[model samples]
Target: MIEDDAAVRRGVVDALEYAGYRTLEAGDGDEGLRMALGASYRLLLLDLVMPGRDGFSILAELKKKRAGQPVIILSARGEEHDRVRGLELGADDYVMKPFSVRELLARVEAVLRRTCERAAPEDKRMIPGGEVDFSEGRIAFEDGVEEALSEREGELLRYLLEAKGRVVSRDEILRHVWGLDPAKTETRTLDMHIMHLRSKLRDKAQDFLVTVRGKGWRVVS
Candidate 1:
């Protein structure tokens, strides 16, 4: 858990340990971000306001690098916008400051359970002009050319194809495919990935992957 307040951190850590959960603590955001990015943990408990590097910034980076990581925001900022922002940024749950230990633990358990129950996407799918083998991480075109797809590319295509015949919002794509909070500024990353996928799929005319203006994207069925 990454929290700046020492007394609160200590109390939470103690409570968690007593409940049979292992704990790691960081007093500041810089150290917290490093550990969050490098460490292997099931869930993260984060604080919003902190000295040097705030929780939101750290959360943004974490989502970009470790999209599937589950996070819960612990903050005194109980405003509606703050909660909405946290959720948009991919926080699985938000616990307000001055919360009960029991409630916090319950939230942790629920998030972990939900995360564990999520199923992995299918390993292979056939696109319009080619076949995408996610397990092989490559696209085999009908014309005998194969193009490699990065992990992110494969995920993007998989999500789009899964939602074929309907427009999938950019926010949905970011949250599901990129494991990011859609509220974070700018979707250039999503746009870039879409561009790359189009090129790799040889959809120069956008016949397979089409963009819906003011909405998101759809894989033509």
Candidate 2:
């Protein structure tokens, strides 16, 4: 958990640990960013209102380097823009302030469970060259360099590939991946993610990705 406020940070971290998760704490977003990059964790609980390198900025930078990571933003401001911005920055979910421990725990478990569910073993994947090897929690390019996938990115790519040429509505992806419905205009977040996968799939470009535009996307091998 990375939060500038001592009370919220302590409360959240303690609750998380009590719920059976091993967590690391950071006083500011900068420290959180460092811990996130250097180590892989199942989830990140971030505070959008933080001192020195706010949550949104940290989220953006972390995504530039590791797009697959799962982040849950916690904020007192609960404005529509705050929620939208966090989701647009690739956050997996967001929790408004004065939330209950039950709600927090539920989101954490739900996010991790969803990630685990989509993570298929490479051996079981039927892709031509190879699968992303999601079960291993890394982006295994057929080229041999195994890049670590942030939890969300791996699951997003997996879901897209599994759509298998069928047009998947943006809302579906949003609801399924983020475990919540962001504003309708926030659908482009899905497009942004697709673009990221396309860039990552450098060599696998012609394999299974086909864009439908206006309507939705399909993966045609």
* Residue pairs whose backbone atoms clash in candidate 1: 89-181
**In candidate 1, what are the lDDT values of residues 1-221, reduced to their tens digit?**
99989999999999999999998999999999988876657899999998877989988987666665799999999999999988888899999899999999999999999987878878878887778899999999889999999999988888778764777777667766676665554759889999999999888999889988897788887
Tens digit per residue, CA lDDT, model 2, 1-221: 88999998899889988888888899987788787655546788888877778898989976655556788888898989889988999999999988999999999889888766775434334444555667776555566765565678788877777766667656556656776543433545666667777666653454566666665566766
Global local distance difference test of model 2: 0.74
Cα RMSD to native, each candidate?
A: 7.8, 12.2
Leading candidate by TM-score:
1
lDDT against the true structure, per candidate, is 0.86, 0.74
Worst 10 residues of 2 by lDDT: 119-128
Kindly report which residue stretches of model 2 are placed more than 4 angstroms away from their true locations once superposed.
119-221
